[model samples]
Target: MIPFPESTLLVPRTLFGRGKITALPALGREFGPRGLLVYGASFRRSVAYGRLHDAARGLVEWAEWEHPGGEPTLDQADALRAAAQTARAGWIAAIGGGSVLDLGKTAAGLFHETAPTAAFHAGQTPRHAGIPFLAAPTTAGTGAEATPNAVLTDSNTALKKSIRDDRFMARAVILDGGLLSGSPAHVIAHAGMDAFTQALEAFISVKSNATSDALALTALGLIAAALPPVFAHADAPEADALMAGSHLAGIALAQARLGVIHGLAHPLGAFYHLPHGLVCALCLPAAIALNRTAMGDKYMRLSETVGGDFATVTNTLLATLQIQNPFKGQPLLRKNEILDQTLSSGSTMANPKRITPADVEFLLSRLFV
Candidate 1:
């Protein structure tokens, strides 16, 4: 068994409350007067953005960059880095969904690096500590705020992968339920599933330890109980729990890593342009079935935590949220490429059951129908 995690990556300071987003400007002051604020259209339409902007009116010189819709890409990170450099920004704060946060985090982490963004994505080590990165998540998923790695797609190569550096960790995180209020029901559902999968995968990971197990289990319970309500009503009081659950799941996964679902999700989502969470949600049942025997007693622990058999509960939850399998009946494009990437993933290596090419083929067979 993997030993307990003695050292872990973490966000140093975190503020949590319903209205904590209003405090962003004050927090930005700690870094300096100039900063970059990265966000998506959904955030821009919300009242929270106004609150953030009004609060920063005289205090922070924020260069705002709005992310055009779609998965985050290397070019987006490069553009953000250029914007930050041009503004001579002392800090970078992202307030949006996972894509926005990943882009912001990547740009901030590479702010001082002279190498192209692709080089870092290709595993080049970053030698500089980036400007401070502060995160306020608008959606209750991804946990990007709590992790030091940024997963971005390279449009040139059509590859999706993470670039990690200890210095890439967020300097501060604001978990405000108010931000979640603006998320669409579908966004809430997809993101919630992503969080649930992360928590579950981390809990059962071969690399899991004492600290990660504790956190991941708690995260699982919280997300399991709160996701449905939050999905049904964005302003539900359960939003707070969902947000916190997602954050804790992110923190846990940072230490324990994940499993084959994530391994498959990255490659499949990249190839099909599917949302990350949707891919995770679709992959859950098959993953649970694949790993059930290998999970040992931990599988029972998960079932108890989520109330009843975990696999049955997951299918019920997916149906409750109207999550359908999109991969069924689609032609399996880039089969070899997808197989190679999934088999090579770091997350795949961390699976409770060692994933083989046959295991991946089985998963693909289930998805492609």
Candidate 2:
């Protein structure tokens, strides 16, 4: 097996544990004294936010930008870029879910770019290096902290996609279970499923290498064991394991890429204004069935890792988390558009099974009914 990806990018430094967040200010100081802090509403109101600010007090100069709501958007990114510029920030640190991190990551990555955010989202290469980006994920999913890509939506076109540059990778990451304590049960459930899906997809990705496979399998095991308890109780003792699993899943996916579930999640979530993790949860079983044949022995390996047949484990978890099919009775919107995007996605192309139009149609059909 290939030892590693022909090319690999990873977060250069990571700090993990209960109060690791307090280190953010010190970490950002490595970049410069001035920085921008991006976060979501819930985080802004939480006590951890106060603790973060207390730590930042004399160590760094931080300008705050609250992610207003909804998915990360090109417009929002541009606004954040402007905010960082106005603050003369030397780095950007985001502490929240995937959307908040994506916004901050995009802003920092594009801080020196001359063109519109849309240009990069449309596939233009970044012409300049961005300020240092640091991440602390509040959710146990997305692993935005470990990736070199930021998924954003272009509201004008309703296209949700990633703007990736090797330089977009975080300079440092803080994985603290303290950040996960305040997330609602639904958020925990959805994010846990998303993390599991990411780990599984990375394990089965055609681009997966020996190193990525090992990391993905470890992540799968950790998430499978920790997710259910964490979903039932956000502050469960296993939350730390869940957070570690999510981070590992992010790293694995960054190296190995993902499958159609992620490929489809982007467009479907954007079009329907659904939560991204929810979309991944709803699409995963179908993807498993689609890729099972090609997965061969690895499929059984995954089953064993998760402590049951993969399909049965996933369905059981979904039910335990009270995840219902939201698309069951809804009309399929933008079918042609969704199909086109799914076929062309970087994630879809990495599927263990080569995905066809018929396969995408089949997956959609399963969801709608």
Candidate 3:
């Protein structure tokens, strides 16, 4: 495995706990005087919004984006930055799910961009210093707060891209479970699946090392136990269960990268505007199977983590995720067509196994049928 960078920074200063979200008022006070608030439509409705707004009152100038659908594409980033500049907001506080946080993160970076959010992803330099960012996570997935990377969409090119590096990492992160209260069952399932894949992929990726493995293992265990009840009760305070896991997974992937599941899922999300969790759910099983074929005993270790043999546990996971074959309802595709789409993810390269295009076809065929 590739060694984790010894000097890689983890979660910048953080306030992670059950109800500690109340500290948002205090955090807003410190970073305040004037600031930009970026959030998603769904999150804007969540009661936590009122609380955050209340806390930030008078201290910050809020710039609300009710529609932060998944990643913020280059266009979205420009609009956000232009708006922020117009507002003259000093700090940026992003409150919502992975998509919202990602959009805010990218916008904060692209606010000073010369090329585009896509160019930033493709190694562009910043002409202006970035604004300070703060992220408050609503779901227990994607650990975007801990990651320096911000995923964006380039709708023009039909691609989902990433804006990365140390600068984008939040100066402070608040993980309060209260924000998770109204998350729907499907979202719970999707976010949990994302967290699961994050930890698992980081553990098995070529970029993994001892630090990442320890963190991944710690995250995998919490995700196994904490996710189900949270799915059933989106508001349930599986506090200790989730905090450690999500952050651990976040930090793990911060150093190591995620595999094919994420790589493949991005295109589907960019192309179809699908919920990230749903696509991730569908891809997880296939990614795992291919990884198993390539890496060997790692599959056994994964099986043990989930509590069964590779095949049995794998099937159970897919069932739990309610994975839908892309071809299932499409009128244009035959069974082979569905398999072809699902099998074509770029993330396939990150699989532990040396999966070929043909191998993906075989694996996806079994999944759909």
Candidate 4:
């Protein structure tokens, strides 16, 4: 459990608007004329790092993370920490998806510490602070760009964990929907669902308070409206809405925390090699049903958001989307299945209703054809 003191949260100042990333160079210059730029392989990404580099000129020093998958493990954090130490970066500019920005956050958190980022994960040591960072997200996925915590897997133990500290929130965040234009449709579909779930989960989370609820609802409304345009249109207003909604969702989850969707989603990424967002998507519908069962009227509000009948609206929305590799797309959502394994992971530990493993078993068993 996080020891969050009741205090006002300061969402990092965001640079949002049409063509606002152009201001990043000036911000980088203000932070430091010379800082480190941490990233994964930029060869296949939305944001053009070369252009950002050109725009920044001598103000940015570049550091690279070897892992490019959207996930970052503790081992990768160790590697990144080592590189950051050698580079002695004054400020970190994290550009890319969740993994990439997470690496940047971890690097800042682990700056003073050395080796085995797992030690920090194990609670043997905790990160007390972080160097400044600027998040430039290339995808409309994981709001790691705005959050204070970073999740990483321990390759040796196979346990995925996080480095949590509000001190890690970025100094600035840049969102440019144009960057997601060329992203693979499969990737976009999965990540977009992840964003949608974030808003929903946070809205219903027990940790939620007045501040988080407002953000969560606004995010939920935007994400629901944005997904169609973001995915269908790709390069236009829809994309912008998707990314913008994702940013809101990220901030909401940071404050309200996540429900079972994430708890169950982690295991799939660890064991099944399924995409994180795909796992989230599979787990979400059943979680909705289960939570509605537990919270009484909470799901009613969500139902109202989409339409009078939540189940019917949900079915209509899920049916309309087409994706590549239907087999792996919503893996647990096969026709024979009635629910997802994440039912165990979904509302099980949720504050209002702590679902048991037996409940998970029953719900998921119904999912099989």
TM-score of each: 0.98, 0.98, 0.87, 0.86
* Tens digit per residue, CA lDDT, model 2, 163-217: 8899998999999998999899999988888999999999999999999999999
Q: What lDDT score goes with residue 314 in model 1?
A: 92
Kindly list the per-residue Cα lDDT of model 4 for residues 1-369, writing each as its tens digit: 334526645555788765666667777667765566666564235356556656766655455545556468876777777777777676777777788888888887767765467777776555456678788777778888878878777776555667777677788888887667667666777787788788888877878777777777777777777776666666767777788888988888877777877876675566556677776776666767777776567677777776557666655555454522322333453212112434433333553557666555544443322
| Superposition TM-score, candidate 4 onto the true structure | 0.86
The reply for model 3, stretches above 4 Å from the true place, is 1-4, 57-61, 68-71, 321-326, 329-349, 366-369
**What is the number of backbone collisions in each predicted candidate, taken in the order shown?**
0, 0, 2, 7
CA lDDT scores, all candidates in order: 0.92, 0.92, 0.71, 0.69
Q: What lDDT score is found at residue 171 in candidate 2? A: 93
Query: Which wins on lDDT, candidate 2 or candidate 4?
Result: 2
RMSD of each: 1.0, 1.0, 3.3, 4.4
